[model samples]
Target: MPYEEENIQQFSATSSSTSHSFLRSRIGLVIEARETAAAITSIADAEAAGVEQIWMTQSPPTLDTLTLFAAAATRTTHIRMGTSIVPTYPRHPLILAQQALTVSDIAPGRLRLGVGPSHRPTIEGVYGLQHTAPLAHLSEYVAVLRAALWEGRVNYHGNYFNVHATLPRTSRVPILISALREGAFRLAGEISDGAISWLCPVPYLLDKALPALRAGAEASKRSAPPLVAHVLVALSEDENAAQDAARKRIQYYTALPFYARMFADAGLPVAPDGTGLDALARSLVVYGNEATVVQQLTELLAQGLDELLVLLVPVQDASRELAQLARLIGGMQ
Candidate 1:
């Protein structure tokens, strides 16, 4: 079957109103830790706080994402679990599909898989893998993954992947692509269930990400899927201290090539030595007292954000701050 026909058939079998409903209902939290126990604790805290979904990133030098989610699945029952992303360079589609399905078996109706071609520094410098034609690689990778996960079989032959296998028919796990730029946003809309964004300002999302995503969805003859923004939020009475901490977090991404370009495109300053980070920091990180923070987030949602995946920036009394945020979000409903 052709690609379009295959996609329609696959989605028809698995797509339901419930999948889209889940996206609209939740205020998600992204939790990261160097240790499995700490991560599971965060998951438990999030669950207890009435957080609807929890996301984990596959940041290198940290606990593996799947392991953390699997451990988290055993520890919590109701809250949903997801990967903000697992890079495609290091893991093949077949292996990723298998691992994701295993997690689905453990967690059942509560797994969302986010996958992407990560930036060059991690893929090339850290992993020592060639970062060539990433768009092509991701396109082919999604094809193979969808074939296996959605359709339960794959006889795919593409430039980057060649696989022939059949996997057990498991529950459909929504696949979201980590999209930053235009091409990536289109790719996510074209093939994947949703798009996961990081370190992008709200204006950029409205101007760039959303438009490209809509175009891709139109091309695919599918409704536009959920667009998840992984926003950095700091709740603090000490404005200066919160801005300082938020700037430090933004600085880390400025050093990265892909994010650096994104920052520049958004007209946020990037100093030679990565100083003068206030503009980007203020735009991306929501820092204020409880009321101010809630208002800022509300304004962002008004600007066409489908979901906000909150990443809490470290600050004084972080635990108390998280609890306060939980209460605020719980009241928002």
Candidate 2:
């Protein structure tokens, strides 16, 4: 069967309209340097505002995502805990699976593991792993992790990473992936529960990704995983400033080879402006007034996306941003 047609069939077979049951995005925060007390307080408030999940994301100069999730999970009882995007390298797949299951043991249905092949510099210059064909490396990584997670054992070997029989947490866990390119997208279908996307346009998800995911799920004999986006937002009438903020972020991502390659593939054009990383950072974000952001998010949701994981950027104020997130979600049906 054609990939698109196959996905449509699979989507109809396994997914409910209720897969999109929630439209108002839950507030998802990234920890940079917030103290644990401050972090938990903020997370607790987010939970109060109907935020269901909080992401312990990893990046440069950030604390470990799993430990942070462990910390945040302890403080808030109801909110779901997730790793926004844990890199495939840096540790054995067994350890990653064990950590994910261990957390699941603590939080149960509240745990989601979002995994990906981190960018080149972060993978090489920072963590110093072998910079390789990232798509291939990640493909193998996801398969191994899934087998270990789902079956509690894996007899697998790969070019980059490997695994042996290992039993882990004896409970259900949702393994989400950070994916964009063709290989990563297909792997999400075949191996993962769903995808965790960032800055991937709604059109791509609608026109391309959803169909691909449907096909993958059918092929793999699993229900279609949820399509979650870590949305960058800044709402305002003069969306131009917000656009500028988004552009500042883009600049930073353009320098990262993995993102740069994906951005190009996404058809967003960028010039290598050597105004430094701060200037580039603005290029990679998404911001507009509430109305504009809503319109953009609507475009995203229309493409069959599951839910918005709102990551509030450095904006008016963290408190105000949180309030705005609550207000926006309150209005969504």
Model 2, residue 181: C-alpha shift (Å)? 1.5
Candidate of highest lDDT: 1
lDDT, candidate 2, 103-174, per-residue tens:
777677787788887877788889878868876777787778777777788888777765678684454566
lDDT of each: 0.79, 0.65
Residues 119-228 of candidate 1 have per-residue lDDT tens digits of 89898889999998988898898888888887899999878888999998854778888988888889877888878999988899889888898789889788777788
RMSD of 2: 4.8
Choose the strongest candidate by TM-score: 1
Model 1 clash tally, residue pairs: 0
